[model samples]
Target: MERWVGKVAIVTGASSGIGESIAEKLVKAGVLVVGLARRVENIEANAKKLATCKGKLYAMKCDMTKEEDIINVFQWTTKNVSLVHILVNNAGGNPGTTLIDGDASRWRQCFETNIIGLLTATREAIKIMRDNNIEGQIVNISSVLAHSNWYFPTINAFDDGFV
Candidate 1:
């Protein structure tokens, strides 16, 4: 991780939960982090708390379901923090709809966020890495419900999407 010190990282869904923890850890390791999520205020608050850390944290409002939002985030990072050395695709959620009885719109929303959004972010990140000749890392985060169905059954429950 010391090698990543002073590097730039983008973490999605960083307003809370696992994403928040990952962002904090990276910042502590001296990695500049751009935290993205719809709840930008939460990230801003967290950034304030982490101000004394070795690295800096920037909060951005991004809705993973929107391609433009994802693209804008990357652009912001490039112009503001430098080319990203790492990207964490940590934003995802289920629409609370079962397979048999589900709303198409809700399911589509889930797919866009969990699948399309991740791919778009990955593609953008890779392009930056390749263009800059940087060996960057992309981390996709998912829930355990992806592997086991014992938990609640949801139409958009994370599974194999990260793959």
Candidate 2:
């Protein structure tokens, strides 16, 4: 972590939960963190709380389900911040609907966010790393549900792919 001081990282779904925790820790290690999420205000609020930390946090509005939003965030980061040295793909969720009775539209939303979005972000981050010749890190956060026998039809179905 000390080696990452003054480096740059992008963390998706950083508005709350595990994403928020990751961002906080990275910032404390003196890494500049860009928190990307639809709840930009939440990230901004947390940024304020961490202003005195060794690093800094910037909030960006991003809807992972939208490819354009994902692309734009990376572009914005390169132009506004330094090239990214780390990427934490921590954004994912189910619609809380069971497979048998779930709406197709909701299911599509879940797949778009939990699967396609992650792929897109990882591809973009890799491009940046390759172009800059930086041996950066990419962390994909997956739930224990992926490996469990406990069935959460909506969640396990998607999360399982990560493992």
Candidate 3:
């Protein structure tokens, strides 16, 4: 934590769940945090509770599935804050639908968010890190289903068969 003091970090899907938890942790650790999510208002509300931390939080509305949105977030963060020193790719979800019975769009949405979105964010973050010579850290939160093939009725689409 001491080492990350005064650094900058970006946490995607930060409106809730793991992304939100990571954002709060980073802020408390003295890292200026940029929280990106489609639900920017949620992150904005969270920022208030984290005011006592040493670092600052900026919530940006970004749809991870959109390349333009991801690009805009990186650009905005660099201009408003500083180069990224950490990136947590925590934006992802499955429709809880069966692969065979699933809507193609929903499957595509999952892929875009879990794979493409993470790559895009990582690429942008690396560019910033390279330009600024910051040896940044990246934490990708993967699904528990990544390692299993269980056939749960609810999370059928989340199994390794599709992961």
Kindly give the number of clashing pairs for every candidate.
0, 0, 0
Clashing pairs in 2: none
Better of 1 and 3 by lDDT: 1
Off-target runs (Cα >4 Å) in candidate 2 are 153-156, 159-163
Colliding residue pairs in candidate 1: none
- lDDT of every predicted structure (CA atoms): 0.90, 0.90, 0.85
- Give the local distance difference test score of model 2: 0.90
lDDT of 3 by residue, 53-145 (tens): 899889999988899999999999899898888999888887667656777777677778877888999999999989888888998887776
lDDT agreement of model 1 with the native? 0.90
Q: Candidate 1 on 130-160: residue-level lDDT in tens?
A: 9999998999998775566554566444333
Preferred candidate (lDDT higher): 2 or 3: 2
Q: Candidate 3, which ten residues in sequence have the lowest lDDT sum?
A: 154-163
User: Which numbered prediction scores highest in TM-score against the true structure?
Assistant: 2
TM-score of each: 0.94, 0.94, 0.91
